[model samples]
Target: MRPWTLIVVSALVLAGCTTTTSGLMARSNDTEVKVNNRNLGRDLSLSGLNRAMVGGRLQARAELTSKASGDLYLQYRFVFFDATGKALESATDGWQQLNLAGGERRQISALALTGEAVEFEVAVRRIVDE
Candidate 1:
């Protein structure tokens, strides 16, 4: 191969190796929870955000761990979004309760109610007792 042809081939190979977040598989594994009503960071942590297409519908999973010494009660919900970041219409996006013991880790999964949801964001907060 010519030197210029070799250089172009090398460049193409390097480009293929580069990681790109332009696709649906590229997701944010955010561990921080910002809540105005309570300090969730002190007692609970979020991680392992994953997304996949199951049965032609988007599915998301998140790992939640309890950092407190005692048991903690929390509520979580999945907010779906399209490729343009617009919220998708879903009746199943409701607050679900979670109970975690100290040093316990739980993986929660939710299936998108609509096929338009290509992405998701998880919102978690402490369950306030009245």
Candidate 2:
């Protein structure tokens, strides 16, 4: 094998050793929750998403719980969409950090930045310590 081939193979192996977990997504219009990461699905639970129009803007609230026995560090972000399903915000809403105690349940809420936002999805992910 050539030296270039050996280097490429080593890089591929290193990349394969790393694991990437996508955030869990829950849609306001859907009852089913989408789990992108199985590990996080086992540790965290997200449900009871409710949305209401307040002062001509959309407000959303949801229940978040930590099933783990220890403290769980996590992050969440809300993506708002219009009636046609087009995203209103350019996904610029940054991830907000959250910490939950063992078996703790909390109500998380977010208000749509724009009144045109008619639908929404919330994504939650674990904060991996490197």
Candidate 3:
């Protein structure tokens, strides 16, 4: 009757899921993306991320440079940590593409953490040679 229909539907759903589960649980491959060292200094260092206050939600990576002063090939990844320095929650281990011209520094691009993780680490990579 009604219970049998529910069971039949559930069985079909589980059966369908079996076909795609082969690679879904596989671990993500490790990647090494180089961070642009020359573009980052104490003024625009990763540490700056620690000192600044992020408004809104997760900060969007900065993607443009102003006046063509200098260019920044930036890639950012976010890792959230609790107040005790232990990783609070995990996020996908992938890099995001971002670009900023040499002198474009007025843009407000940054992401904020959503959970109780109080500490964060951001890696900025230089996509183009400085």
Candidate 4:
């Protein structure tokens, strides 16, 4: 095979390995939660997130701040996971709405419905207006 052809083939093979995996991946306790702010203003950001055991159940709190010149609408949810990395089934864990004015900061919190939750992840996304 030509040298250039061999290099191109190897590059294609390596690129295929970068595809997303469907299986569960191990996550560390120090992993930072990712928030999708694409549709929101650039001045909005997630400041902090903290998780703790409250009343024998998992409790999560997230702080959001908006430095924009207007109000920002968004949605957030808490996904609880057990020690084995399985997500806990709970009907109450649904997307909740949030509104933040310019230069405003707000803290949102959620409690696990059961004691089986050992870890939690918070996801935030901008609410697109129709």
Candidate 5:
């Protein structure tokens, strides 16, 4: 194995690992949202978030609004975190789908499966068809 060949192989592997996933990300403390898709980002927005502790679990209600004049098909998922900002659950059942009518506002809520969750992040993405 040559040194240059090894370096090139390592670079390729590192590049592949750094690939980013595009979506809309919102946190409990931030009013600003990160949108990775231009069309979806422009039409959809996160309006508000309400959090509470219920039954020893973290409960979150996220308000989503559509500014577009047409309906939007989207999916969203809630990621739970503990006081240290470590994710509490993974391998979720996949994103939950929803429909937002033009100029419509809706609230979606989720309860954490574990009591250790004290923080949460919401990820919303457009549903794409093959």
Candidate 6:
């Protein structure tokens, strides 16, 4: 089937259907993530996907900047959907550590759901692991 891709905003990563081919889509300056609760900000919305994702090999292309160097972790989650735009199931992966250059753009990748993955959703959370 013809594939579609969506961009997910993360200070913490979540699950669902979306595709990201490394160098395929460039930096998306159109959207921004900010936590409305406090000084911490990370936004989540739909971007760069045609008609949303139902199921397939979904991936998220995120550009993140670490507040500090050393070792950092990224949390990701995914949501699945049916053909009629209904939420099927949601899955959240644990924190994956990633080393950053303090002020650098890092692209995080995921395999998403396979086989019967018609459409999907995603999330990302920055870990403050010491």
lDDT of 3 by residue, 1-130 (tens): 9999999999999997873211001001222222333334421432223223355233333222333455555555565555566654444445556676555453323344554545454454445454
Cα misplacement distance, residue 114 of candidate 5 (Å): 1.4
Best by lDDT: 2
Where in model 1 is the C-alpha error above 4 Å?
A: 1-38
TM-score versus the correct structure, for each prediction: 0.70, 0.82, 0.42, 0.69, 0.79, 0.40
User: Against the unseen true structure, what C-alpha lDDT does each candidate score?
Assistant: 0.74, 0.87, 0.43, 0.70, 0.84, 0.41
Better of 1 and 2 by TM-score: 2
Comparing 1 and 4 on lDDT, the stronger one: 1
lDDT measured at residue 41 in model 6 versus the true structure, 0 to 100: 31
Residue 65 shift from truth in candidate 1, angstroms: 0.6
Those runs of model 2 whose alpha carbons end farther than 4 Å from true positions after fitting are 1-21, 90-92
Candidate 1 clashing pairs? Answer: none
60-106 per-residue lDDT for model 2 (tens digits): 88899889999989998888899899987733488889999999999
Worst 10 residues of 5 by lDDT: 85-94
Candidate 2 vs 3: which has more TM-score: 2
TM-score rank, highest first?
2, 5, 1, 4, 3, 6
C-alpha RMSD for every candidate: 14.8, 3.6, 13.7, 7.6, 4.0, 15.7
Per model, how many backbone clashes are there?
Answer: 0, 0, 16, 0, 0, 40
As a whole number from 0 to 100, the lDDT of residue 3 in candidate 4 is: 98
- The better candidate by lDDT, 1 or 5, is 5
lDDT of 4 by residue, 40-117 (tens): 536676656777888899887777778698887777777788999899865457778888898999997888888999
* Count of backbone collisions within predicted model 2: 0
